[model samples]
Target: MDEEVIARYLARRDAIDQSVDLVVLMGSAVLESVEVAAEAHRTYAAPILISGGIGHSTHYLEGAVRRRDCRSRWIGRSRTSFAIC
Candidate 1:
């Protein structure tokens, strides 16, 4: 793994303004999305918008989110309110 890239990615919020409206999570980022989005909801109190299909991690993500006490609700336009996609 690229430590530099991971460091920069993890530290990305430091450069962004704290005032955010919403967060969108997509693609094959199962656990990462859960972690980030859950943290964002806890920290920012913003709603999460997760979008994606059944990638390899889909079932794992669903199970992970549920295990974390996070719930996934179906939203409009084929989107979801929680971080499982």
Candidate 2:
């Protein structure tokens, strides 16, 4: 890729970061995502949503967050509790 093109892409990414309403963490960055969500919650009081099952690391991440008493409701997969009313 050209240097100018890469720079443009990075600039666009920064723009998106500035305008995003919610941040989701997944894949290999789950741990980092947890910390970001928690801190963002403290600073902005914005809701954070986390979902997984893409790989084996999801379970470990979920456990870590639970151990820390992270306040979040689990949705999707086997954690959901919704009725089609």
Candidate 3:
């Protein structure tokens, strides 16, 4: 990627929307998503809606939480509720 293109992408990506209503965390193998969701919630004071079910990334998600010592609650098998403080 060209430096100018990368800079433009970063500028757009880092732009914050002032009218955000919720922080959504889609279940994935990447633990960084969780961190981002939590941070968003903290910054926006928006409700978080965690979406996903048991899949290839289930174990990875669980492991990531453990590794981070993240406090979380499971709302059945598909949905999870995270309290961002």
Candidate 4:
């Protein structure tokens, strides 16, 4: 996971409130990225929308698998508001 990217995203999200009703994140790493984003969104009170489809080949497959794994881990956690797709 890229902490820098996550931190930047969090900082940006923190700059707004209610202004954003939903946030959509793409990419296989979305699961982890969303987790970090969700934490930041908690402070601003925003809902999240996670999106990722099966990959085209092996590389994509790997990403999808990792994302799925992360998603499973996030399943039972309670937070401000979020969703996985």
Candidate 5:
């Protein structure tokens, strides 16, 4: 993703300052996109809820492994909920 797009997302996230219980990041960019989202969630002091299912476009096991790795990395200090959907 471009830095400009990421900056925009971060700006939007900074505009809100409420407790968030869940965050669902979907689509092809799930691996990296959710990391950025998780950073934003930390800034808001919110737990994260990730939801996405491996589709024909990607290897199911690989996607699941990557998502799990992301969860493990970010699951510290904040509660995390995950569902493959």
Candidate 6:
């Protein structure tokens, strides 16, 4: 990765608020992304709005739920809501 890109990414990441009213988890292929969002929700007691369709990350999402041993039950289609265990 370029130094400039890394710097910009770190800067934006460091600017995030410690707590928020909501956590919008756009779909990602990485389990760590989901874990982070889940942690945010737990820490903030905020509702997570799961945007984006499953797309190509179906297996990744399922694997994450299993690996984390979370009974993730999605409610609704298109934009959904779920809570991690």
TM-score of each: 0.47, 0.37, 0.57, 0.39, 0.41, 0.51
Off by over 4 Å in 6: 1-12, 15-19, 56-85
> What 10-residue stretch in candidate 6 is worst by lDDT?
72-81
Ranking by TM-score: 3, 6, 1, 5, 4, 2
Mind sharing the TM-score for model 1?
0.47
Best by TM-score: 3
| Model 1 regions lying over 4 Å from their true place | 1-17, 55-85
Q: Give me the displacement of residue 21 in model 3, in angstroms.
A: 0.6
Q: How would you encode candidate 3's per-residue C-alpha lDDT over 1-85 as one tens digit per residue?
A: 6999985773354659686798887778676666788888888899989888778876776776666665444324343444322
Looking at model 4, residue 85 earns an lDDT score of: 43
For residues 27-65, what per-residue lDDT tens digits would candidate 5 score against the true structure? 443355656767767776666655544455455534564
Listed per candidate, the RMSD to the true structure in angstroms reads: 5.9, 9.3, 5.6, 8.3, 8.3, 5.4
Model 3 compared with the native: what TM-score?
Answer: 0.57
Give the TM-score (vs. native) of candidate 5.
0.41
Best by lDDT: 3
Which regions of candidate 2 are displaced past 4 Å?
Answer: 1-20, 27-30, 54-85
Per-residue lDDT value at 3 in model 1: 100
lDDT of 6 by residue, 23-82 (tens): 887776455667787878887899988776656776777677667765545444232344
Candidate 5 wrongly placed segments (more than 4 Å): 1-14, 59-85
Please provide, for model 4 over 1-85, each residue's C-alpha lDDT reduced to its tens digit, 9 standing for 90 to 100.
9999987876463345246566666544335665666775676566767555545443553455456664564456543222444
Question: What is the number of backbone collisions in each predicted candidate, taken in the order shown?
Answer: 0, 0, 0, 0, 1, 0
Q: Which stretches of candidate 3 lie over 4 Å from their true place?
A: 1-12, 65-85
Between candidates 1 and 3, the lDDT winner? 3
lDDT of each: 0.63, 0.50, 0.68, 0.54, 0.54, 0.65
